[model samples]
Target: MTESGTLYVVATPIGNLGDITQRAISTLQLVDAIAAEDTRHTVGLLRHLGISKPLLAVHEHNEQQSAQGLIKRLQAGESIALVTDAGTPAVSDPGALVVQGVRQAGLAVVPIPGVSAVITALSAAGIVQPGFYFEGFLPASGSQRRKRLEILKTLPTTLVFYEAPHRIVECVTDLAAVLGGHRQLTLARELTKTFETIHTCGLAEAVAWLQADPNQQRGEFVLLVHADVQEKAEGLDDETLRILQRLLQELPLKQAVALATDITGQKKNELYEAALAFKAANTHE
Candidate 1:
């Protein structure tokens, strides 16, 4: 039996075609076939690179079905390169299922790292937070999105998210409401493109800024929210801190803070803030 061939998870340029890596180019040249999230889109990239190969559709709609066929090809000793419309594959994009299938089949899967919107934005975001949670794209529905943000609001680390141009205004508005208007938000749009823009301001002001200039809402977006900086429990008495911590272990943050507030006569908001700091410190440990 012939040995299975490798699958290359190639990372393509998010915007500037010039960002394409030389190694990625060489891999594309050598792969037996290229599996793309969007054939039409990948074809354009291939055309620009002056390389040609058999293109197969492996987009979000048909990823699972396509993955089976890809595995068959690998088993038949045919190498395949996986790519998305832009940026790294399988990262808030299609191609993850294909990679998972190939791995389950015991075929070699390699990464051809290149430009990523998240990293590209972070490189210029100037955020000093020690870590960040990449919450790619939020729910499209306003209610669902708000609930997600509420859950994430208390996280002490930076929160990163991607938003579409049309939903940018609404998304920011929700961020301001759920996460708080005072939080700093860095908006990175159209990275590596001619109309690229990176602006940072309070979440409350983001909607106004985007609305004032229609052009700002155009293109892709990467939003980085500053880390939550609530005060620790140092100001509270030892007994209050102890009660809050114990309650947190047994209840949801809201319920725990509420109960702690009632029991200790401490302010609810203060207890909530202290709870967040406690969770953040424990999360790392």
Candidate 2:
């Protein structure tokens, strides 16, 4: 910081208190003042850690006003820390304005990073990572939320979204219809909590399981939707199976298998069976 005041961005736990990092603890202990998205929630966290500091609420409604006060605190050489109720601050969370405004005032913004639910969920998902789209919380409204899902339908990459516990079942149903039932999907719930559950299934089954358990309707959620079976492989028939094996003679096995199965809804096993039979027939001739 130009004048010796600095703002630290602290990450709190999503559910379990033990997830907080030692560096975050030290930073919070060191800061002169703290800005929180919710004072009551932050108070509980501080109480858990036995920390007492001046806290100012800096939520979405009054970010502009809060920015001015936090800047003043920094100007007066009071070190400040920003935190959200859960996860790292400013990632679809509060602390954006505080972090941004402090940097504009020529103050240093230090990030005290810890467990993030998004990253936490992704790590457990078995999908191979190339690039993923993080769609943090869908629009709460029906039409708008489905529309948002619709827009993401064409994206050919692993997709992630944050969901409220109550609306997740409905969201999955919509996802099943729009994204199709066959897509591989993963759902994570109440992460790091005692009843933490992660399940990978076809989209339709995930909806059914959520419906069966009344308790599943509670807690934080993260969902991963794998890309749909791809446009080139959209529809195929059994008649094309033989031609596919012939084409595979000069092509790599994986690409040939993808195209062959894409053109014929035949099980990969059945296609491979036909391929073996074709090879034997050609060898015998």
Candidate 3:
């Protein structure tokens, strides 16, 4: 009876080869076998590092068969490593099925975190929204993608999605319609590459910016949009802060807070505190 072996879930660089971590490099070199999403794509990475090993294709199409062979290799006392074409495997990539199979076969799955597009985009976006949701990439066709957006419409946090250049315009339009035109958005393209560009504006303005740039129609992009700003509030009060900001021009702090709270459904104490702070700051200036 052979005891099962360990499977390393290693994360590769999204674009830059320098992004590979020391641990990931060491693991890939030390593993008995590496199951790659694309052996041809991974060959370049291996050659760059001067490390050579057996490569197996384990993408969505062949994951089942690949997992069986990999499990047998593990049972034979071989350590295996999994690498996607880019970034971390199983993150909108193709290592999930193999990982799930490894677990079912009673093998250990250890993650080797390094570079990822999702993390890279989020960090450089300069968006300090309370939190954000990563919805990955939407479906390429049919009502499936629209259905996803309908659910995305209700989230109160920032929305982030990965998109291809060809579909970028359609994605922006759909997002604007579902999330509203006034929603603040940032479109980051070719991240970490030589021609990286970040465009920040409302939904409509983002679409316009894309149109203005004839060359921006190429490369991958990460789309981020504010989910909080809305014209009409469902349960919470609408325009409380804006009303308070407006009334401060005419009324005193106390009066403005009272009026704003009355007009909107916001809590009186919260509105009063915010109003007081706003008034104090303005008065000081």
To one decimal, what is the Cα RMSD in angstroms of model 1 from the true structure? 9.4
Q: What TM-score goes with each of the models?
A: 0.81, 0.81, 0.79
TM-score of 2: 0.81
Q: Report lDDT (CA) for all predictions.
A: 0.86, 0.77, 0.78
The Cα error of candidate 1 at residue 183, in Å, is 0.5
On the 0 to 100 scale, the lDDT of residue 45 in model 1 is: 96
Q: Name the candidate that leads on lDDT.
A: 1
Model 3 is weakest, by summed lDDT over 10 consecutive residues, at: 276-285
What ranges in model 1 sit over 4 Å off?
1-4, 232-285
Off by over 4 Å in 3: 1-4, 231-285
Per-residue alpha-carbon lDDT of model 2 for 136-193, expressed as tens digits?
8888888888898889998977789989887888888888878866565788889999
